[model samples]
Target: MADYLGMLKGEQLVSLSENFDYVTATADFVGLKLFPAVKTDNMKLAIAQLTKGGKIPVMALVHALDTEARIGDRPNYETMNVELMLIKEKLNQGEAIRKLIRDTGMKETESEILKAVFNDANNLISRVLTRVEGM
Candidate 1:
């Protein structure tokens, strides 16, 4: 929680943690050249919560004169997504949690504090994104 950094969604990257649906759901959710980080699965619950608060994903009207292309025997969008994910989403919060447990023993209200902080931060981020997108 120091100086801010940056993030994505698209299914170009898959984590063993997100094995619930098809491996390509993230990519399938968006078309092309939209939010480079277009994704919903990783934060599905968060977005849903914000939407319930009357927020929505930022959208655009893409207008192309010749938006036609031929499928070639080349790499697909998934490959690109994977590369983007490997480069972008590399933070391991799990390690942070482990260190907290080790250093503090996670005693007393620590567990509750951790849960509340994580949940609230996640929801707050979703709301912030929705608000920013609207602006």
Candidate 2:
């Protein structure tokens, strides 16, 4: 479990809880790669809450490619893949949702959250199949 938390200068990670649930539950939309990063945590938390209810939801937002530029006004910035992978790994490991947040780097604020409903449904199918086979 490598620590994926990056160096923080000033409150790096942002949460997107309310907006995410509103968009997903109401509009049934998934996020794209280049959507705004604002409220990312809120989005993540909302999905985690759904999982608690036995529903594995999928999030469609991509790691922002321009975070560094916005952070430091510098060019040649790295995207947030490493952090995303770390979060994904945590999900796989059954770590609490809050633990994942404690370990990642800063996320985007304005990223649009696409609908994860389809992806989530597909994942559920595979998981159920695996369990059925094991039985």
Instruction: Kindly provide the TM-score of model 2 when superposed on the true structure, using C-alpha atoms.
Output: 0.18
For every model shown, the clashing-pair count is: 7, 27
> For candidate 2, lDDT tens digit of each residue in 1-135?
123223232232233222333233323222322332343543222121222323444344555776543232223333332232112211232344324344542244112111222134345444543443343
After superposition, candidate 2 runs with Cα above 4 Å error: 1-112
Pick out the ten consecutive residues of candidate 1 with the lowest summed lDDT.
Answer: 1-10
RMSDs, each prediction?
18.8, 27.7
Model 1 TM: 0.24
TM-score leader: 1
What digit string (tens of lDDT, one per residue) describes model 1 on residues 35-123? 55455455222111222323344344565788754443422222112221222122344556555555765567564544533444445
Error of 2 at 96 (Å): 14
Candidates in order, TM-scores: namely 0.24, 0.18
lDDT of 1 at 34: 57
What's the lDDT for all of these models? Answer: 0.39, 0.32
